[model samples]
Target: MGNLDGKVALVTGAGGMRGVGRATALKLAAQGADLAITDVRRDASDLPPAEVRQEWHSIDSVSDEVEALGRRCLPRYADLGISDEIQTLVRQVMEHYGRIDILINNARAVIGRDKVPVTDLEEEVWHHFLDINTTAVFLCTKFVGQEMVRQGSGGRIINIASNASKQASAMGAAYSASKFAVLGLTQASALDLAPHGITVNAVCPGPINTDRMSYWERSQADAAGVSLEEFRAQIVEQAGRATPLGRIAEAEDVANMVGFLVSDEANFITGQAYNVNGGLLFH
Candidate 1:
């Protein structure tokens, strides 16, 4: 039997194949939990804020993979920036599965090229990032927590955070600040939800291998007039030098932590920020 047998989970930010959310969703599904996956890029102009078309298959593919794991999967296009849409997502999941036991808040505003220092950051970018990254977490948790309470079953809530939560990053002031707020929300919600038999925690990952990381490097390379290949190598070397693990983390590394946190083994843990950074930073 799987650890999460008979459980239902909702994973946000799951459309990106190389993203942590996709990994976490698949991992949860592998453990025997039915999945409800969401991604921002469901509608035209989801990211980059430019003209585009809604590609439902982006999320469908994820759900298909989950179903292949022998569990039910429901994928939806979600705009966490809208409170009504957030509520609707919860309702849809509940209608399908009747209950939700695990909620993974993994979606965030990840426009790597748009990052800028606090002094140079535009107000629009700042608010946009905050709306999606920080505010969405609050909305998702608030709505999902209510569902868990109504179900009368204790549940688990895991917030995907970043190394920026604890340390400063170059040209990542807004991102860092947003992640820091996620940590705060995790702790405060854990305290409040503890009485309701719900557990809330945060996972902080550093320099993981993902398309997002690739884009991050490419953006830097462009600014420095270097090839993408050289930029990629430099980043890997820098991550290895700074981290005791001697390399950046893989997507599965973070997923492994998520799997553990949602399992029965971690029943006693809550309100803590666990780092999957391969010892990049110690606390």
Candidate 2:
């Protein structure tokens, strides 16, 4: 009896236990949508300590949670950066579910060696990030949008952008550039898909409480020669004070926004990017 009772949603990068992708999948599933979730095959040892402790088997565990909520789930492994893999993913979903009612483009390049001054960044790393962040988004949206158009009933496509979309990151030139392009793609795709009744929007989140943020924070802590514990506390305090809401955000906070955007409630909203930054940045 949920709003998306017969709908199917494809969420990429859903393997992270505390990531927005997993939360969004559960949110959409709770609202009655069958899920097709994908992520790169991962090793348990490489996961965050929390995930390892809890024995979270990435996408498999996520699928278990979705089915527990009484919604169907199709879990697959696809390196989003590979164009052929993405096409195969779409075809697999079509062959399995026969229709895709929503697409959550939540996968992106992981922040890493590229988190340095532009002058210090490697050309190879730059293209790698763009391939995963920008190119992958393009491929997913293109293929999925085609399916939605063919369906003729419209659909929802949500891109997990970043606050970096509007503001440049100090040591994140490649990351920021990718996100900026995502916003542009979102707007352009929104226009192209509008006539087809499909709504495309971007969710630009700020510092969130997730493993990805933890890794970034650790990098800073190491650079400053400070203890991870001390640096973590200090940054959280500073970020909380800077934000209007007086706190950082949880993964579910962004997921809640995604749930709303995909629902009928946001039917009239499209071609726009919403900053789910706890009021840290206002436009």
- Give all candidates' CA lDDT scores: 0.85, 0.89
Residue 249 in model 2: shift from native, Å?
1.5
Query: Model 2 misses residue 121 by how many Å?
Result: 0.5
Against the true structure, candidate 2 reaches a TM-score of 0.93
Worst 10 residues of 1 by lDDT: 44-53
Report per-prediction Cα RMSD to one decimal: 3.5, 2.1
What value does the lDDT take at residue 169 in candidate 1?
80
lDDT of 2 by residue, 1-283 (tens): 2399999999999989889999999999999999999998766534566677787788999999999999999999999888999999999999999999999999876666787899998999899889988889999999999999999999999999999999996888999999899999999999999999999999999988776534565678889999655786787678878889988888999999999999999999998899988888887
Q: Model 1 over residues 59-155: C-alpha lDDT tens digits?
A: 6878888988898999989888899999999999999999999999998886664466678888887887788889999999999999999888899
Name model 2 segments beyond 4 Å from true. 43-46, 213-234
